[model samples]
Target chain A: MIDMFRRRFISVMVILLLIISGCNNRQETSSTNEAGDQVITIRAQTFGDEQTRIQNLEEAAKELNEQLKAENKKIQVKLETSSFDGSWEEYRRQFILAFKSKNEPDIFLTGHEDIAWLAKGDYILPLDELKDSEAYRDVYPTLWESVTWNGHIWGALQDTEARPIFYRKDVLKQLGWTDEEIESLPEKVKNGEFTVDDMTRVAKEAIDQGLVQWGILHRPVNGPEFHMIAKNFGAQLYDPKEDKLVFDKEAILESLRYFESLTQKEKVTPESMTSMEWKNVHQMMIDGKALFWYGGIWNIFNYMDQGAEFDYLMENFGFTLVPATEKGGTPMTLSHPIVHTVSSQTVHPDLVIRLLELVAKPEYQAKHSVETFHLPIHERGSEVEQFKNDEFLSQITYMLDYTTFLPNHADFNKYGDAYFNAIQSVEIGKKTPEEALKDMEVQIQNDLGDTIIIK
Target chain B: MKKWVLPYLMLTPFLLLVLLFFVTPVVITTIMAFTNMDYSMEWNFIGLQNFEKIVSDPNFSQIVFNTFIYVGFTLLINVFFALLLALLSSYYIPFEQSGLFFRALWMLPRITPPVVYVLLWLWIFDASEYGLLNTLTSFFFSNDPIAWLIDHPMTAIILVNGMVGASFGMIIFSSAIQSIPRDLFKAAQVDGASEWSVFKDIILPSIKWPIMFVTVWQLLSLLTSYEYILLLTDGGPVFESEVWPLYSYHKAFKNLEFGYGSALSLILVIIAILLTGVLLKLFKFNRMIQSSRIE
Candidate 1:
């Protein structure tokens, strides 16, 4: 009788362990609080440098409060923000996690072109119904279409991206490249006369002259940073029509072959080039270690914030938008619009809509753009007197005239990452370009399934 | 009635905590993994699917290898250095009371905020061509500076983590050795035993249980320690030194795939438990000496 009971107890304990272990998963998470008052507390989150997030929140809250008071409404409006902006990936995830709760913010910013995915997944509210009456559609025929997912528009623009190569005028001046030479360089680069071959030669010349060791270093490990350059080289990333990941294996192969040549063949760029991320490259330029840096327009303020005088840096610095292929096309400037999206779960979506409408106004957008130190793509990008007059901003605006966005499909982030990793592998010699691209195609077909065409 | 009642009462809190913190989440995550738990914004549960999806993910293999390399390398070095320090510190040299102060100081690096240490390592292991070690090499030795973390991440993180873990091993071994009877060593010495013989037969046997305990405990710790790597590399330059813990964290937080992250964590816990069991079994010392019944 005793032995029987002991065995029974042990078996029960084992069964209980299995049962409890099964219960430990996240599927069991329930709603936080019972649904409450219907007042739309539309919440939005945006990340910036520490001080910038705080300032953005404070200003946004103030504006929201003013609008609420003017409406004589009882619906409460709250915006929660922090200056503790962690990594972009962390911030994005936290926002997504927050959405799981009943108390999630009603609105948020999606900086990547994959706003379509959030909409497809139903995290972001579709804005296509609002498109008919929306005055902002006049900016471009495809401006809103880029954010559309499953035949519904989802995201709205807050700001877009512009990248131009900041160069060392001192080195170029010493090379006897005249004003004529400087002005014609972008055109030459577009015409294929100035290939990565030419860029490598310049880097080599700079190294040999002891002018600088790093001639041109973008964020070497930056996935998006490389994509920006890749698309410019006429490397088609995906076939949206076929919904497949199509890496122009030949084009990407050519690009990576050239990318590695800078390190292996030309010996102009350092082997540590793979280790230096975007911020490091920008800093290296400011610290006078590198002669050229290709990055977003935001670097202008970042340098100024670092105590680098704008005028002092400008004397020996000028910029040109990275040119497109030697195919005489508009140099592709890769941009992803940061859009202010309304939440489907928001209580006061109408009020939130009003706020977005207010901010989307040219004057409000211009002021916010000036404060944000970013190039806003709407009328705000051109109308801001500060940007129009500032020499650096002037150059940046010129770069924006022929800009392109990263692919915005739901699976584009995954596809973009695969493309990047494959190229990085070849560039680092972990795999040859042909081998990497072939493997990438197989993997993409497996993982992405009909999401991207494998060509 | 009383016998069953008290036992039930005693088990309540532990059982509740296990349910709340561990069991419940594991169950939920397993269920979630089958379905897509992108976020609460869009949650759908599908079954055995999450496991299949994760196992088949292209990154799953390299991530696993990197994780094992990072954890295994750190645990081995930490245990080895710790044993060495513990053995050496047991000596009663002149002015040796200062070893206590030195041990405490040795713990300083570990006590310092990981964020601060990460920054210091950034300077020390900078991939910049002219970064610290590189600068030193260029100025003093005439060799190009090494890219510490990027190219050789496993070694870099192992050294940083092992150095921090040394003091822990030292403290445990020192106390455990101190508890042993001094007469044992005297008896071995009186028998004309060589130092190596004395160490192997007397000292080593005496500290076996403590060594096993330390190894098991450090295995658990080293496997979960993602700080040095997180602050330094962020699983980057193509996920070189991303251990299972960092991979789980990135999956949940960076990728916004909580269900998958939870599944990855389950695997990590299993690995940790298995490693602990293996450590204990390998040692053959079940527990501390119960008054030395050596036959």
Candidate 2:
């Protein structure tokens, strides 16, 4: 009886030890897989509430997934974003705080104006090595060239969309302009035959015909867009050569006087437009209250996404770069590129780059371009079968050649705010054209302090 | 022992919560106020420098003036209007529901979200010539647009803020006026007191506490309030609408000087505490309330 009891006890002990060993084996496998999970987190300081950018990011993710899954690999990515909502000043403030944090983002997006100064910080890894890869060489040349800093590739471009003019074709038809004449309008602008003066003349005719209430509409709010308008008339905010503000007072006054007449004389714009908000401009053109609208490619995408059948508007709409001084002078529109970058401080950089690379694939780019209705950053992506067949996109495509850029200075935010205020002052008749220019020049100089002044 | 136990038990959670959430943060923020730490709260104490910079700056002088202007000016305007509203809503008014209805209507602006109300005020003060007020003005007078935010920054802010202020005093004054004993009025009536005389003597004494209460409360609110101004003008063409809280927000966020912001906040707290003490003493708040309750 004693021997039997001892044997049973030994069997029970053996079973318990086996169970303990089995549990240990399972933990080892779980731990090993966790280390190999290949997940990356990216953070950016942007307006978090912007439904547009969020939608674009998701569409890009879906496109990237299609490519990654095809390669039998999956890269997990988490995006942390902070939005300032409206205030650029507050945006910059939060950026400084987040930038000072213990862990930095793996990839971030910023405008071309920010790339020159903040990119100088040593925390960001240079994109030179990645750009040299065959994958990047195949992307859009213009996008790559813009973000390149001091002859070194610094960031990757999502894409840059140029602001183009939108005009009502229904009004043009009523004025007896054939479809051919509308299509040939680009040549007219290019050949020195078309000027803003000519635009006013045509707009007046349209207004007389009761085509629309206003002749032209643009967001003249407190943003650098107003600076761009001012620049078109020879007002350069900064002198890149002297590295200081070179106030082209003569040019600024000329532009302001002409701008004033749009409301004050020609009645081309509503008197209320002096205080018109930015978002209001886009909405106005769609509602047919305004005859023309000035916006970037995203507006075109938004309209199409709204399920507005574009065939009719697409026929009526024509794109023009904002007019320069000479009749045939090259019209200019700014192409502001939103870039995606890998974080230097990230723990899983390899995973981040892999995910970025997957999204950078031509097929993914083309798919996202189609899904988002955004123009492509890849040469091949731009020439995709989808964009080739789309007529409205083709018209926007013609406007891409006219794109330019604004100052890439980090302090541009400070200068830009004051500059827009100056524009508002002129528009509202508070300050005469000359006084506003003088104020803007002084304001720009004040904010710039002793920072390196770009020409 | 029993007395001590009950009081301690009752007071323990209240004391602990105040210590944990409020006192501890204030202490940490005060320490931070001295530091120049920039990145990820990596603080190194610099001592008194942030405060010195704030005091010496020209902007600080303007900020102090703006704060006083907001608080002092709003107190006067808010009190007068509220008093008027209160008087109108009393039995003197012809409304069917006896001013509760009118009082309720006035309360609408108070209950509205600070953001939404600010936006609504913005729409009213739109810079366009065709804006609501602008259109009305143009139809009668000049056709040119008024830069409402820039030209009359302080007045615009005050009036937009009047919507908030008018309600507080009205509510308080109404309740206080109602509480006065009718016996006092009956005696005054028998003695041939006019309505004005009854109001001057009996009603005035009864509601002086509410007047002081609204005045002191409005002062504190106007001093610290930042949202309406922030939404409307962002304290500019220059720092025109800037009050103390806005000054702190600009310092921390725009200037990237968190330490300076904390220092500014500490100063504001000290000022508010001092202001509260002065008000309490001037009103004899504690003594009057206890005596009134006993009576």
Q: Quote the chain B TM-score of every prediction.
A: 0.86, 0.91
* lDDT string, candidate 2, A18-106, tens digits: 98565533111111125354444455444433444544555455555466557766554555554447665554444544455533445
Can you tell me which runs of candidate 2 are displaced by over 4 Å? A1-105, A110-124, A145-154, A172-181, A200-212, A235-274, A278-280, A287-289, A301-312, A367-373, A452-455, B1-73, B88-101, B122-156, B189-192, B233-295
Docking class of 2: incorrect
- DockQ score, prediction 2: 0.17
Give interface RMSD for all predictions: 5.5, 10.2
For model 1, how does the per-residue alpha-carbon lDDT over A1-455 read when each residue is reduced to its tens digit?
44665676677778878886655432321222233322333456775652443344446556766766677653444555443256667666666656555445566765756575566666767776556645464344445645665566776666665777777777776766897786677667656566555666787888888878677776665556777777766778755565455657667777777667766667666666766534556677887767767667777777777778878777767767675555445555666667777767675566666666555555555555566556654654467676576666655655555676677665565566566666656655667767877777766765566666534
- Which segments of candidate 1 are over 4 A away from where they belong? A1-42, A50-80, A129-146, A183-195, A239-245, A277-280, B1-7, B33-68, B92-97, B181-198, B235-253, B257-271, B285-295
Candidate 1, residue A278: the lDDT equals 47
- Residue B31 in model 1: shift from native, Å? 3.6
Clashes of each: 30, 12
Measured against the true structure, the TM-scores of the candidates, in listed sequence, are 0.85, 0.76
